[model samples]
Target: MEVIEVKDQDLASTLSNNSKVVIKYYADWCGSCRLFNPKYKRLAKDERFQDVTFLNINAEHNPEARSKAGVSNLPSFAIVENGEFKETIFTSKEEAVVELLNKLN
Candidate 1:
């Protein structure tokens, strides 16, 4: 599975159409963001997360996008499905991602 790099303008359209979307808010300079990168990619490749659409948005590059998504923290994950924001999972752990995926499924 490929991760989609999202911009502010495309947020609404992407969330509206995608059945399951996992939007990650991250900053380049953040150590936690860097650490979580591989886990995020692995989650995207996992069979259990196959139905989900992974979107990565650089918070520093797109502050407006981050603000609109209510991302007050770095390395945050928002689970959206069918245009609804299901859950906002925040943690640096890969297991947390797995838990969120299980909850969504």
Candidate 2:
């Protein structure tokens, strides 16, 4: 349940290959993104999310992924299940993320 750093070139392929995927779209300059980093990592390592493929996509560098995920804010979280886009959590709070992951379980 490690988080993979996805680039613009690998975004599509990664999505195509993984069934349950959680992508965190972030920018280096964003303070909120920085703050959310640890939580995101913890989520990836959690046993509950073991089957989920966790990914980190740079919003500025990966426009295609950012647009596909409909990320309008820094540190946006998008979940895809069974090759379909399930939901996008637009909060920086770790609790909200935990809630969403709980729903998946």
lDDT of each prediction vs. the true structure? Answer: 0.84, 0.86
Candidate 1 achieves a global lDDT of 0.84
**Total backbone collisions for each predicted model:** 0, 0
- Mark the regions of model 2 whose C-alpha exceeds 4 Å error after superposition: none
Q: In candidate 1, which residue ranges exceed 4 Å CA deviation?
A: none
**Residues 1-105 of candidate 1: C-alpha lDDT, one tens digit per residue:** 988999888888988888888888898799999898888888899898899999999988887677766788888888887877777867888888788777778
Estimate the TM-score for candidate 1: 0.90
Steric clash pairs (candidate 2):
none
